[model samples]
Target: MNDRSNARKEQRKKRYQRQMARQQKGSKRYQRTRLNVARIQRYRANCIKNMAHQVSHHLVADSTTMVVALEDLSLKNMTASAKGTVDQPGKQVRQKAGLNRSILQSGWGQLRQYLLYKTFQRGKLLVFVPPHNTSQECSRCGTIDKASRRHQSGFACTACGFTDNADRNAARVIARHAAYGLIRNKQPGQELSTVTLRPIPY
Candidate 1:
């Protein structure tokens, strides 16, 4: 969808520029081109929203799922632009901008919002555990090391020599954390205003 959107955006940009140069600012042709661009953007937004709804509904409605655990991610902070002020210009501005666009395009915030309300309405527990070291930690041996996930999709534990998909390992870790009641108390309607977790028995 992003690729298609970018292609369409480029094509529309050229046409819009040409129309503005030749036709008047408030001319019919210029207005028409602007409307077309807005329509395409709206369509993309609807598609992303629908996709998030479907995925969130599935997780909440699944009979086998009593608790759903996810990494506590701040989408806004994760996708912030790296363009600094003129006094101190930022580096990798182009790459950061591209990454920010991709993150926003993926609708992570929308998905989380859907999951939040749906899970609450369905009477299911939704927990967000700390996301740090989830991908690097080995699910089998509980070892934490950066080398465990050397590839994007692969994971291999250096301690136990266990191999699995990186995403799957992270999911397992999240589930285990939830099972152990390792989650911050931040959900709505909760009386506690502080972070709470079960103490691990040594």
Candidate 2:
């Protein structure tokens, strides 16, 4: 029992060492390491933005009276969620496992910006909706609760037993929000609130 306990402690110590090692920075000689990383991040952001533009434009250009409903995610909350959930140690562990940086690197706002201009070019309206309970609210039955979602991509409502893809449900909720003129109304001091479309190039 004593040997078994010692082994367990040794194993845990090694695991923690590995975790700490993964978080280490490059040497002082590599002071510009962040620049290289930033360039790569910018590349990824552009690629994702282009893809979003292509997808948004394709969806809108083919349909009459197209409205691109999207989420108006609070940048403040976005940053926080990217770091760690407010009440979970597992989230911190997940961060150590590489989930956190992906959230930060995703640049969702930038993708939305690219999509916005592209949609306008195709003569389609892009709408931003407040993201309150998009994941929890059931589109088919209007159920709003935390337990409705099984995962990030699945929503199962208890109120009406409505089950749908999570992303699809979110899109539906966003459409509902769009109908409420959320995109047009700006928060007291947001740049997106001041956004307007230029004439599409003919």
Candidate 3:
């Protein structure tokens, strides 16, 4: 799907460039190409927004979990330009630009906003915990060493030899933070409190 989208975008770019070079700015051909590109962009935006709505609604209404916990993320800061001033330019400008584009295209903010409203409307408790070190901390032994998450998809705790998928571990850490209000120095199941909330109809 992404490949097809990229192909269409590239084709539109070439067509638009060609039309701009040959046609006058306000000519029919130029206006047509501009409108075509705008339509494509609007379609993509609607697709992303619809997907975000579906995912968020499903998470709140379809899932059995009453407590929804999400990491408090600053998408704007995450996608901000890494390029500094001309005199003191930043490193990895191209890589950061691509990363920022990818992040924006992922619709993280849209999903979060949908979840916020849906969760509240459904009477489900939604909590946003600090995102700091949720990925680096070991979910098993509570170790905060960065070496535990040496790989993107893999996590192995250096302190206790605990191994798990990186994303799953981070999720567990987030759940633990939500459940116990602490991320470290706690025994398994200690200080953890779970209160079951009756499902409320929307």
Candidate 4:
């Protein structure tokens, strides 16, 4: 090999060797580095909260209804699935390398915090409900189906022929669940129906 290629290979060999050593030692330096790596996560989280606050605050202020509904994403399922990479060789390939890190970093949690505070400041009610079936359920007729999500960015109901944004559909379901709580202490437990909405009469 040429001198330059030989040097590059040596550097990579050293790096992989060090990484393996770190894995083996399992020492304080390793732990500290991991903690430092987590700082990226922390910063992204803060950004998400801030954006959620701004967006939710605007939505609540502009809307006629003061009730703000939020999806409970504490148990995340979908966003974690977004991982794909093209074929590349002889490089440190990070899964998050080419991702739109800034856009995703906007901080949904921070936005939610902003919404909660703003709603409280404005004397409005903010509510959260389970996030299941929100995207799959029809907003107009209260239909729920696994096949409703024809694609990632859209929702189309086969049973009732209702169509709308996925987030909006989820928001409507959250609102309905919130309203059910207001009328009675216990929220409705029955499933949503497309042809005949039972609990709140969609």
The lDDT for every candidate, in the order shown, is 0.72, 0.61, 0.74, 0.58
Q: Which is the better candidate, 1 or 2, if ranked by TM-score? A: 1
Over 1-202, each residue of candidate 1 has an lDDT whose tens digit, in order, gives: 4677667775776676676678777878878877876776787788779878887887777766766776777876665546656886678777778767766776778877888898799876678777788889888878999999898789999889999988788888767776555334346665542322221110
Residue-pair clashes per candidate: 0, 0, 0, 12
The prediction achieving the highest lDDT against the true structure is 3
Give me the overall lDDT of model 4: 0.58
Question: How do the residues 47-166 of candidate 4 rate in per-residue lDDT, one tens digit apiece?
Answer: 456556557656667545466666665423334333333544324324333233322444454556676788788877667767677768787788789898887668888998788777
Top candidate on TM-score is: 3
Model 2: pairs clashing at backbone N, Cα or C within 3 Å: none
Regions more than 4 Å wrong, model 4:
1-50, 75-104, 186-202
Models 1 onward score TM values of: 0.73, 0.58, 0.76, 0.53
Better of 3 and 4 by lDDT: 3
Q: Candidate 3's error at 61, in angstroms?
A: 1.1
Residue-level lDDT of model 3, residues 24-99, one tens digit each, is 8898888888887787778778877887787677678755667777777788776665665698667777777876
Residue 202, candidate 1: how far off, in angstroms?
Answer: 34
